[model samples]
Target: MMIPRMLRCSVLLFLILAVTSCVHTPPLYVNLSQHNPIIDDYKALTNAGLAQRCCPEFPLKDGWLGGDGDVSVPLDATTTLFLFSDSYVGQQNQTKRNVPGTKIIANTVAIQSCKWEDESEINYFWNRMYTSNPRPVFEPKKHGNKFWVNDAFLLEGKLYVLLEEIGEKENAAPDDVFNFTQVGYTMAKIDNPYDTPLTWNIDYLPLPGFQHPQTGISCLTRHKEYVYFFINNNDRVQQLVRKAVTDFEDMDHGFEYFARDRSWQSGIETADMDTLFTGFRCTTVKYHSAVKKWVMIKDIQFKTNEIKMRCSPELTGPWSEERVVYTIPETTPGNEHYHENNFCYLPRECTQNYNSKSCEMVMTYDVNNFDLSYVINHELIYTPRVITIYLPVEESGGPEE
Candidate 1:
């Protein structure tokens, strides 16, 4: 029963189309919540009152607070601490009482603690808000400080915080030539987060060989026995580099880069590292045990006002394509504050919800814009927002299977 050649070819083409249709999965829908309690509370305190305080007085000006660092460390099941950079406190436009001419209120690393009996009952406490005396967790040397904390990871009951030392002028254009002289990290005891004049153990580590002069370590993640540093290179590509968990503190050795061919190699040469994903900055990757996958939430550099989610089966992986999980109306082009940059950064603590089938992730972004309208008329928009995302369930007996 030999079929005619054209008929056979047509039948094969139809079969292939059917299989492809069945195997192709549609993009996951991101569910933005109608009500974000955190933002609501912020609005109530800052916008609804005659006083008009954008944030609490403890961390930033008149409470006109906003900053970019999203490194979070979970101390226990119910307690978490969030770290901030370029935090301002006191009057929005006031000179530091001590530094005569300097208008910067506070050039320090600020922290906020979130305590919860359960997921639904979380309470946030600023370091200085409710206390008789308030202070920043980590203070910088002076105004226009170049060093700022970027990301952190917990190991052996200690927190390792990565501090990026910038050799460029403050507020330089994104494309400006910024020099990264050295990449250093510091450590603090997990239990001593609130120590005044906090004691920190500092050390410097050589940048990964593949790192470009403009590249910086955006985030850190732990998988199996290694700690992976996600590098944001000048070309807007994300590179994955790793160091054995045991040698993390050693820094002089045991570091390797994921090469283009997907193999681990012991060098930092730009040519040796592989590009795991592109257009990612300020990312957080955590393992989802329930689904046995690594889930990453990050800011898409190429896509303004958009935050994306990616999943992978391995640490250094064939990561899933970026899915737009959330977008900010304020940062969109033509919007009132469109000129200002916005980022949706996921803290490492948010990974607690990763295993849940239905999970809500809270992300933070800067709400400041140089636009006159935003500075004078806008309500306090600098705060964290919550977004709910559901991981896709695997269907049984797929066409490929």
Candidate 2:
């Protein structure tokens, strides 16, 4: 009898565990506050000392700004920055967070938007898309539950936004509650996303078949004919790829199930971004320069658990080990401001290339407190930060598998 694939994965995991349960690395406790002073000299030349603790100031007084995720796209003669955020009333009804506006200065574009989409708004938008009597392919649950629709990208002069729906039954049982997380994509035609409301030119398709894929979506650059997306399945943070199916029919709406055998070679620890202290929110992006290369950055939970960077040339098998890029010092509440979800680096044309050896990167991350018991309270307070990381190309070119 043929062994089932799922069981085979279990057996393989057992064997790998049975053989090498002994090897281990010394635990390193990373404190963001008492960091080494000399590391300051190691700052990248382009955005020197720019990676400081920052809290995005919400533009409106009534608005409480949090859950900030962003995508930067180049269209026409300029680059437009679209920042999608969770705008709502804070605890105690002290303030409100509304979607702000986009700011363009010279060649740099920055969007200070706090409002993106709420549960009702998305449901209304999705409902109107189908215009059918039968229920549509996607719909948001009517509870006060929330879903993320923030991952947006630019392809072929159109803006593609990945909408994530996480649902819960209106009156779910204490144990039998339902949480559905799937990725659906939509596109807009405006040269800049902030130029118009996201709902104006949006049309969507639901992505299917991946085990409990988290609401977070990663767009790992397009290579020739393939566009890779890294999604966290069942919070295990599995990596999967899909070729660009631009044809309306072929690309309409379908996804293949990625078995364990086809998993990304790396993983974040099972703990939250704070406890497991290794891998929690896993996301990736490819840096194509003189030679093609891919880099993966994950939240490495340590004392405060820092977000670390690792690089690999090829997606399948053989990945360069993990390395620490920037550890948020304890004095600075880096983790307090940056959470998981997604991150994108500022491209070459936008910054100083005086030195061919290095380039500055501005990273966007989901920010909030770690404890789940504090879910509702923490959600509103979560603030996103854009930090700069200097990528040293020469040192990172250490062979490829």
Clash tally for model 1:
6
Candidate 1 versus the native: TM-score?
0.63
Compose the digit string of candidate 2's lDDT tens values, residues 1-401.
Answer: 11222211110111110000111222232221232122111122322221121112222222222334433332221112333433232222233333122111101113321122210011011112212221222233444334454344455444555545544445555654133333343322333333323233444444443224442344444445445555554444444544453642244343332334553232232222121112344443545342245556664443343556555666542455556555443214453434442222211111111112323344544444434334344433344343445454554352121
Q: Which sections of candidate 1 miss by over 4 Å?
A: 1-64, 91-144, 170-215, 333-349, 353-357, 372-379, 395-401
TM-scores for all candidates: the values are 0.63, 0.51
- Which candidate wins on TM-score? 1
lDDT per residue, candidate 1, 1-401, as tens digits? 11222311111111100000011112222121221222111012111211111111122333324444545554333233456654434343432323222222222443322221211222222335423343444433443335556666566545566665444455667654232243333332233333321343434453433333444677777766777878777647878778887766665567788888888888565656788877656467766543456777775454356666777888777887877654555567775545544433342324432223222233444444444244333334334333333343342111110
Error of 1 at 145 (Å): 3.8
List the global CA lDDT of all models. Answer: 0.45, 0.34
- Please give the range of 10 consecutive residues that has the lowest summed lDDT in model 2: 11-20
